[model samples]
Target chain A: MLYLVGLGLHDEKDVTVRGMEAIKGSERVYLEAYTSILGVGKERLEAFYGKEVVVADRDMVEMDSDEILRDADKVDVAFLVVGDPFGATTHSDLLLRADALSVPYTVIHNASVMNAVGALGLALYNYGQTVSIPFFTDSWRPDSWLERVRENLRLGLHTLCLLDIKVKEQSEENLARGRKIFEPPRYMSVPCAISQLLSLLEEEGQTPAEASSDDAVALNPATTLAISASRVGAPSQRFVSGTLEELSKLDEEAFGGPLHSFVIVGRRFHALERDFAVRWAVDKDNWNQVSNGVYKVRD
Target chain B: MLYLVGLGLHDEKDVTVRGMEAIKGSERVYLEAYTSILGVGKERLEAFYGKEVVVADRDMVEMDSDEILRDADKVDVAFLVVGDPFGATTHSDLLLRADALSVPYTVIHNASVMNAVGALGLALYNYGQTVSIPFFTDSWRPDSWLERVRENLRLGLHTLCLLDIKVKEQSEENLARGRKIFEPPRYMSVPCAISQLLSLLEEEGQTPAEASSDDAVALNPATTLAISASRVGAPSQRFVSGTLEELSKLDEEAFGGPLHSFVIVGRRFHALERDFAVRWAVDKDNWNQVSNGVYKVRD
Candidate 1:
């Protein structure tokens, strides 16, 4: 049996008891490391599980999944993912491969940012299609995500923007020289994502999608309310809500570390939602001033 | 400290190791039993954790929360919630009360249907605002959820319909008599939900929301495709896909038991999603005919 176990967000203890039992009974365990990272290291997990764990990078899992599923029909093999097993499409692809090979598998679900973002006091059901924001380069900057956010905003739905994490990436120079050297890991911070979004809105304002239409409105950084969540599901997690313009100028130290997420508040906020969110406001007085006019139906 | 720990979906073993540790160290443990339920009972969880577990019903949680948190500030109290602590806004309210009382608390995240629904092969990011379907009565039938579904369908996004479960509910007669008598637990099955939806659509067709034009359309049961999932995150879980008409006529026995979820498939479908869905089709040939015409792209 091939068991796709989820190491829920945070440290080693986040793994469910059932997941731990599966790990104990498994002959071989492989941890997928590229998609997301745990708060603790592999050694800590090894110490807890008391089993040797093989770290599987993107190349190994995407290219040589057969090795991961080898002899699964005869023995229990555990494949661990940082978040929920199906959080990423790649893991679903792996499940399809297992099905093709006639290898029975089971998924152990855990909390992922897809759901954990609810910790910021936003109702999960009020969120629309989630979008990912990739790091923008000097020459290549994509604005497809802006359209998604726009659609969600138009529908009065919150938008969860999953900031990108570039792990084990190679520099252009190293790639050109055929060198295996990799660059340092980079995780998009809240300010960086806000800056990219601001730039995209500015560009869109200059060149409207349709020339015939003069009502092509852009997202206002000064009035758009957003919540910046850092290290969610961790002990030191922090959530702060404010306008995009106010949040964009926030100190880098405000957000402790990696794994930051942003939520663009929609126009329709329930009184309870607004109340809960105000408690996490970066500047309580400013938030009250902006939210009084922004959020619908004051309590 | 007050700890809001999630006992993930499914059985007692679904609780995280950290949750188990908290339970072990907690002086008093209260399980919130109204929002959602686990496959196992309180006794099973009690046996697993070797601790006494108190079940908190809607009344206790909504009305008597202060009593639950009376000594929590000075003692280690665990308020256990099925799925993630933040899955329901009520729990967030409880956290707010804890904050008001100056009680430090920690949240232990676990899998909720919000994320576990991804096991059905649909991309989580493609899902729009989720809606809940309540048991329809002669006078209390609501079609507000239909608008949410329509919005999602218009955007080509999947709609996750959370079926309502009535636990420890009192009848109007019993309530009027001021009796403590409770009705048997009622879980909304897939067939019942479809019937309600179809009836609502039929009613909408007869009397349109506004008589401004005749172009206001309603969902066609015969052509709509949906996926019925039962006991998700459990070992005996099942997922079946078929046209809404066929699914509506399906026997209740086919769905097994309680905790069923329905997903109304949108217009857009990636080939991978189509292929994965077709694997669980009630009628493979019919599914192909319907999906081929329904899914936007072949690839």
Candidate 2:
């Protein structure tokens, strides 16, 4: 049997008990490391599981997954994901391939960024489509996500923005030379995301779609409410709420470290939501001013 | 410190190692029972933790959450929720109250229906705002959720419908008499939710909004696609896909037991999603026909 286990957010101890059982029962274990990483290193996981785990990179998982699944019908093979198994579409590809080989598989679900974003006091029911923000290069600046944020704002729904992470990536020159060199891993910080968002708002000016509806709103750098959450689900996780103008000015040391996510708050704010969010605001006076001017109080 | 722990979707064994540690070290352990439940009973949880687990009902948690935080500053108190602590807003109220009472707290999140719905082969990024479908009473047959589904379809986004769960509810007559008696728990089945969706579609004739857009779609009882997922994170979890009409006609035995959720498929159905979802179709021929007729296939 093939087992797709989830190592929940944070350290090795975050994995569920059933996940431990799957790891213990499997004849071979492989950790899919390209998509996301646990807070702790593989050595810590090995010490916790008391078993050696094979690390499967993006190439092996994408090009040679058959090797990972070999003899799975006869022996149990466990493929561990950093979050829930279905967080990315690539995991589903592996599961479907297992079906074609006539190997039965089980999915052990756990918390993922999709749900963990609710840790910032935003209701999951009020969220629209989830979007990902990639690092902006000099020539490749993708600001299409701003329109998605606008669409969500049109419906009074919050948009959860997943910051990008570049891990084990090769440069163009290295790929041509067939070198096995890799760059240092980089995780998008909340300030970088906020700056990109500000750039989008400035670039999309005067081309903004429908701005007349009573409940309709747009992303204004100074007036739009925003939130940044980093290292969520860990005990030391930090949440900082401010306007885009306030957040885009922060340095790297302003908040916690990597794997940060930014959120564009919707116009339909409730008193309860405001009450909870006020505690984390960089400027409570600015938050209240924006809440009074732009947000539509539900109750 | 107050610890808000999440007992993930399945049995007692689904709790994380950190959760177990928190339970073992806490002076008082209270399970929040009204928001949702674990597959196993309190006896099983008590046996696993080797301590008595206090069942905190909705009244106690909402009305007098301060009492739950009593002495939390002096000693550790663990209040567990079935899913993540933020799945329901009431948990936030408790946390805010803790902050007001000078009781520091930590949150341990787990799998929730919000993210667990991705198990049905749907992409989490494609989901719109989630809507809850309450059981329709004879006098109050509310269908506002149908408009929410339409709004989601207008944006080519899938809708995650949370089925209603009523537990330990007092009858109106009994409540009027000031009696503390409770009624048997009622969990909404997939068939019941599909029936309600069909009823709404039948009632909402011709009042539909702008349908001239190329991708705009409406919920047709005979053609629109739907999926029913039950007991999601458990090993025996089941997922079945069909049209509104086909799923509405199914008996209770067609799905697993309680805590079922329904999804209304949107227009943008990718080939990968279709391939994965086709395995759970009630009728493959009907699925293909509907796929060809209604779904906007995204290659």
Candidate 3:
């Protein structure tokens, strides 16, 4: 049997009791490492589970999945994911492969950022289609996500922007020459994402429709309320709510580490939700000023 | 410290190792039992952790919370929730009470239906604002959720409709007479939800706006595609996708048991998602005809 176990969001202990039991009973355990990172190291997980975990990078999981599924029909082999097994499309693809190979599998579910972002006091039901913000290169910068955010805003739904993390990425030159060398890992921070968003707006300013009418754009950085959260589901997690302009100018040290997420607050706000979210603001007075100005609707 | 530990979707074993450790170390463990149900009883969880578990109902949690948090400042107290601790607003209110009392707390996150619904092969990012369907009565049938569904459809986003569960609820007469008598639990099944939705559409036909134009309405029972899932994350889980009209007539026994969810498929369909969803259709040929006719967009 092939076990797709979720390691929750934090350290080794985040794995469910059922997941632990499966791992202990498995002959081989593989950790898919590229999609997300855990707070603890591989060795810490090995020490806790008393099993050597093979680290599977993107190439291995995407290309050599057969090897991971090898002997699974006879023995229990565990493939561990940092979040829920189905959090990423690659893991779902793996499940499809297992079905094709006639290998029975069990998925042990855990918390993913898709749901964990509710910790920000925003109603999960109020969120619209989530968007991912990739690191903008000089040659490649896409602003398609802006449309999604706009649609969400039009419907008074919160937008969760999942900041990108580039791990073991190769440069264009390296990829062209087929070099195996990888660059240092880079995790997108809140300020970086805000800057990209601001640039997109600046670019939109040049467009005829945007220049002719201010009402055409849904979001204005100076007035729009947003929340910047870092290391959610971790003990040291921090969240700050304010206007986009204020968030864009926020100090890098305010959000201490990797895995930052941003939420563009929608127009609809329940009094309770607003009060709860205000408690996490970097500047509570400013948050109230901007939020009240932007979100006039009340429950 | 107060620990809000999540018992992931299924049985007692679904609790994380960290949650188990917290339960074992706690002087008192209370399971919040109103928002969602667990496959196992309190006794099973108690036996698994070798600790006395207290079942905290809605009254105990809302009215008698002080008793639950009594001496929590000095003793380790664990409040176990069926899914992620913050899945419901009540839990967040409890957290606020803890804060008011200056009690430090830790959240042990686990799977919630908000994320676990990804088992339907739909991208988590593609879902819009989730709506809940309450049991319809002769006089209290509100169809506000139809507007949310229409908005999601306009944005080409999937809608996850959470079915309501009435557990330990008192009848109007009993409540008026101040009696403690409770009615038997009633979990809204897939068929019931579909019937309610269809009825809502039928009611819309009488409205002036809906009567004037057929294209203004977003959902059609005969053509709109949807997925019915039951006992998700449990071993006996089942999923069947088909047109709304077809699912409205689905066998009650086909879903197995309670905790059923319905996903109204949107216009956006990645070819892969369409293929994956079709595999679980009750009638593959009919599903293909309906889904293709409705969700024509392909990526």
Candidate 4:
């Protein structure tokens, strides 16, 4: 049996009973580490589950996946993901592989940041397509996500920007020379994502020279209401709301830790949502001024 | 402290370790019973946690919310929800009420149908705004969701249509005459949802004089590819994919059980998603015909 278990957001205690059972009973346990990370490390999960866990990086999962599935037809092999196993495409590929190999698998579901972002006092139903904001390189800066945000705006729906996490990634020098040296892990912070988004808007000619006065419209740097949330689904989860420019100028330390996510507020707000947003705002007075004053609302 | 614990999708065993601990340690445990339901009953939850779990229906939650939060400032109280605590707006209301009463709370996250829908071979990021398909009566057939689906189609993103579950609902006569008699719970099946959607499109004149030749776009009823999944996170989970017209013709038993969710495939497709969809398809031949033949692909 091949068990694709989700170690729900936060620490080891977030693992469900079924997932824990899969880990304890499996002959081999592999923690998928590249796509996302929990607050606790592999050692913490090891101590909690009382089993040795092998950390599977990008190479091991993408290239050496058959090793993880070896003997799975005879014994239980648990492949653990940070959140829900289906958050990334790699897990789907693995499921197909298991089907081809005739190894039946079960998915033990857990909360991912995709759903956990609702903790910021936003209703899940109001969100549009979820997008990822990657770390901008000196040479490679992708602006395709800008159009997605615009599309969400056009439809009057909020967009969830899942910040990127680069784990065990090598520098250009190492990759070009076929070396194995890896750079330190990078977790995109809320402020960094805001700044990158602002720059991308400018590059795409979406950000006007003079920002719009409307405080609620997204893609407008000066006034668009946005949220910066970190450590969601954890005990220390924190969320702050402000305009895009203000969020971009704030220090990353204000958000506390990694595994952050950002939200671009939609133009269409339910009456209850306005109240909810105010209650969860960073500065209630400022939120009130912006939301009640100039937040351009559509139906 | 009030613990808003999420009893994740499917069964009692799906609860996280932290959520379990919270349930055990709390002085009072209340299982929220209106918005959604777990596969198991309150008895199963009580047996697993070894605590008396009181079921809080819509009346208890919306009308008597103060009862749930009473004395929480002094004693630990656990209010359990079926999925992630924030999937419904009522949970947010409870949080606000707690805030009004100066009660501090913690949210223990768990899997929700919002993210669990990804297991059906579709990427999470590709989904557009999630919409609810409420049960329609002879008089009230809300078509607002139709516009949302159309917007998703316009943006080239898939739409996740969450079927409605009516729990502890009173009949109109009973409600008007001040009676407490409740109707049996009704969970909208996949076929029911599809039939409702098709009728709605026709009612709105979006069905056209004749159905389009296309098999990929939504709102056309005939050719739009869709997926019907049931018990997404459970051992007995089942999924069937076909064009909207064919899916509407399928019996409810095809999906096996309740807690079903439906997905309307987007006009755009990644090549990998095509293969994944085929692998998970109920009839791979028909899926290929719709996808490979006239299915529109937009970047």
Candidate 5:
């Protein structure tokens, strides 16, 4: 049987009781590395599962998925992922391969970052389309995500911006030249993302449009945001709040490390949520005022 | 300290180890019952956590949040949710109340249905504005979600249609007279959702537009979907595959029980993903034939 288990956002312990059981019972365990990295390293997962785990990079999964499924058909092979088994489409490919090989499979689900964004106190239902803010290169800055955010704003829905994380990604030149060089994994910070959004809005001449809408009245340079940093499921989980402009101004020391994401508040806000944002306020910069009763309307 | 923990989908075992610890350590544990419910009931969670849990209904939370946050300043208190703590905006209000009471708060995140739709082998980055298809009433067959879905289709982005769930909802007469009459919690099924979608499309006269748009290829009844039913994190978890049209024909027996949701596949499927879908084909019906290759491009 092939088992796909989600390790969740943090360290080894973040795996659900069921996921741990599947990992422990498997004869061979492989961790899909490129799609996403766990807050903790492979060593920690190995120690917790009490089994050696082979790291499966993009090459191993894409170029040699057949072999992985072949082995699983004979013995229980567990492929562990950072989030839920199907969190990324790549993992679904693995499951499809297992099914093609006539191998019995079981998927053990766990928390993934997709839903974890709710930590910012936004209603999941009220959230519109989620867009990923990629790290901008000197020559390439995609404003495609701007249209999505605009639509969500128009619908009075919150937008969950998943920051980009590039791991084991090869440069165009390196890939064309048949070199094995890879850029370092990058996890976009919330502040950097907001700055990019502001820049894109200005570029598209939508700065005024973004600012003038009643839904976007709370957003500005000094507008507050709930930024979550650190490994969520890890021991050192951290969350901070500040305006978009102030968040960009603060140094990395305030956020403390990798895998950070941001939430852009929408027009509506529940009284409790507004108070929650106030606790994470950036001192005197309080341009983003949540209205009196935002949660009164039921979705 | 106040802790908001996500129980994830499904049963008690679905709770992350960190969430379990928090629940065990808390002096008082309150489970929010309005937003969503687990596969099992209060007794199951109480048995698993080895602690007495109080059901914080909507009225209790809206009217008497202070009672739950009263001693949070002194001792640890946990508010358990079906998905992530922030999945529903109500918990954010609870946190704000805690902040107002000067209670240090922490959120233990978990996966909610928001992103779990990626299980269908669709790229998370390509999903556009999500819409909620509410259960239609005699006088209120809302079609607002249709416009949002149509907009998403125009942009070649996937639409995550979150089916509505009605829990402890009152009848009009009961609400008008202020009575305690309540109906059974209702979870929107895939069939009902599709029927509504098709009817709304017909009403809008966008059937041909939706059916023949080269740009809106991702929006189709035959588009691949992850039809998941039952408690995802529970032992009885069940997931199936089919087009919206095909899925709408499935009976309750095959779909299992409550808390069912689906994901509509978007364009831009990876080559590896296209090959994977071929293996999940049931009988003579192929998902690929239904929803032509949205991934094919001349680049």
Candidate 6:
């Protein structure tokens, strides 16, 4: 039996109980590392699952899936993914390969970013579309994502902007020359993304899509953006909500560290959400309204 | 400090070890239940966390966030959400509220479906926009999603169709009558979603979107869908890939149970992904060679 298990978002213990069972039962365990990875290291997962996990990079999974599937036919093999097993096409490919070999397989899904963007109080149903903002280069920065965000805003839909991550990426020259050179993995920051977005809005000629509501929430390319930085599953994770301009000026020191993402608020902000946003708006009083309640401690 | 932590996709185990530590250390732990839920039940999570969790519904969150934020000022508090905290905007609102109150807070992120959809080998970067296919009533079905999907198709980008889920929603009549009423939560199935899509396409006097793609992979409105059905994060999880028509005829007995989603393959199939999809194509041997290694996974 081949088991494809998701290792939630954080450290080792994020694996579901069923996934844990599969890991324990499997004759061999392979952790697919390229698709996505836990904030914590592999050793942490190994310590928690109490199993030695073979780290499978893109080469192993994409170039040598047959080897992984071959063992599945004879033994209960478990392939661990950082998010949902089917979260990446490569993982799906792995499943297809397993099925081709007539190996019975089960996918143990876990939380992925698709559903998690709701943390900003935006209705999941109200989000029109999601697009990734890639790191801008001197000559090859793209603005296609900006147009999509415009459409979502015009349609009264929120836009979830996924930042890009460059992992084990090879330069065109390296590939052509048959050299196994790789660029350092880089996760895009919110400021970098917003800057590129600004340039896109300029290039696209500033035509913001219209929204369903009477209010036109478009063309505010510099509108309020909710930013979250270093949201590792760790207790010290940090989130900041402010206008894109304010966020743009955010000191890297204040945001703390890497893996930052930004959200462009669209139309259809409920009155309740507006009230909440007001608290973070520039120069707002009664900030203490957020502090007038009872408290409880579990520990 | 206030902590908004994502519980990932499944059960208590889905919470990252970092999230677990935060929960263990927090003065209080409140599970936000209204936005979305883990595949596991409340009781199961409580048992695993070994803590008395306060269930905070929408009413408690939207109407009573002050109470939670106030506590955070004096002590550490953790609001647990399914998937990533930022996956939903309500959590973002909560963070903004916390910020206004001078409450130091953090966000522990998890995997949400946003980036996880790469499982279909669809380049996350290539996706133009995402649209939600809501549950259509006898008289109130909306076709706006169709227009949005059309725009995306024109741009040659993959679309992630998020099916709708109506939970704890009241009926129109109930709101007018001022009576406490409830409606059953409805999760949109891929077959029903396609049926609506086709109907709406015909209504718009447009050619069926499926016709543009190769017929084998193009799922007409009545086609059975390639559905991943099961408690994605739970133990008995299952993923079944099939046609929209075939999936529509699926015996409930065979699909296993609730919480199902479908992936509509886009036109631009990557070479490796096509290879994988061919293995699952309806006619494995007579597969269309889109590329060297890419094939659509058929139902």
What DockQ, between 0 and 1, does each candidate earn? 0.67, 0.71, 0.65, 0.73, 0.48, 0.30
The residue pairs that clash in candidate 1, if any, are none
lDDT of 4 by residue, B1-299 (tens): 99999899989899999999999999999998888888888999889999999998877898998999999999999999999898765377888899899999999989998898888777888889989999999899988987788778766689999999988889999999989999998999999898998887776566444433332343666567888788888888888888888888788888888988889988666656667777657678877777766464322
Error of 3 at A112 (Å): 0.5
Taking the tens digit of each residue's C-alpha lDDT, what string does model 6 give over B4-104?
Answer: 87776666766666677778888788989875667767787778877778999888898899987776888889888886776544565667767788998
The CAPRI class of candidate 2 is medium
Q: Judged by lDDT against the true structure, how good is candidate 5?
A: 0.70
In model 3, the clashing pairs are none
lDDT of 1 by residue, B1-299 (tens): 99999889999999999999999999999999988889988999999899999999989988898988888889999999999988855376787888899888898999998888888888888888999999998789987888898888777788999999999999999999999999999999999999999887777653333511322123566567899889889998989899888899889988989899989988756777777878888888877777777454486
List the lowest-lDDT window of 10 residues for candidate 5 chain A.
Answer: A290-299
Error of 2 at B258 (Å): 0.5
Residue A80, model 3: Cα distance from true site in angstroms: 0.9
Task: List the candidate 1 regions with Cα displacement exceeding 4 Å.
Answer: A206-218, B206-218
Off by over 4 Å in 3: A206-217, A297-299, B206-217, B297-299
**Where does candidate 3 chain B have its weakest 10-residue lDDT segment?**
B208-217
**For each candidate, what TM-score against the reference?**
0.95, 0.96, 0.95, 0.95, 0.84, 0.71
Which sequence of candidate numbers ranks them by lDDT, best first?
1, 3, 2, 4, 5, 6
User: Where does the lowest 10-residue lDDT sum fall in candidate 4 chain B?
Assistant: B209-218
CA deviation > 4 Å runs, candidate 5: A136-158, A166-187, A190-243, A265-275, A283-285, A289-299, B172-181, B202-243, B265-286, B293-299
Fnat per candidate: 0.67, 0.66, 0.62, 0.78, 0.66, 0.47
Better of 1 and 4 by DockQ: 4
Displacement of the residue A16 alpha carbon in candidate 1, Å: 0.2
What DockQ does model 4 achieve?
0.73
* Candidate 2 vs candidate 3, TM-score winner: 2
Prediction 1 TM-score vs. true:
0.95
- In terms of lDDT, model 4 sits at 0.83
Q: Per-residue lDDT tens digits of candidate 6, residues A1-299?
A: 99888776556766665678889888888988775657788787778878888999889998998888876777898888875665544465667677778998866656655555455455665665567777888789777676677666665556777778788888989989989999888877777777776666566565444322322444443443444435434344555666566666766665565556556766555555544545444323322221121001011
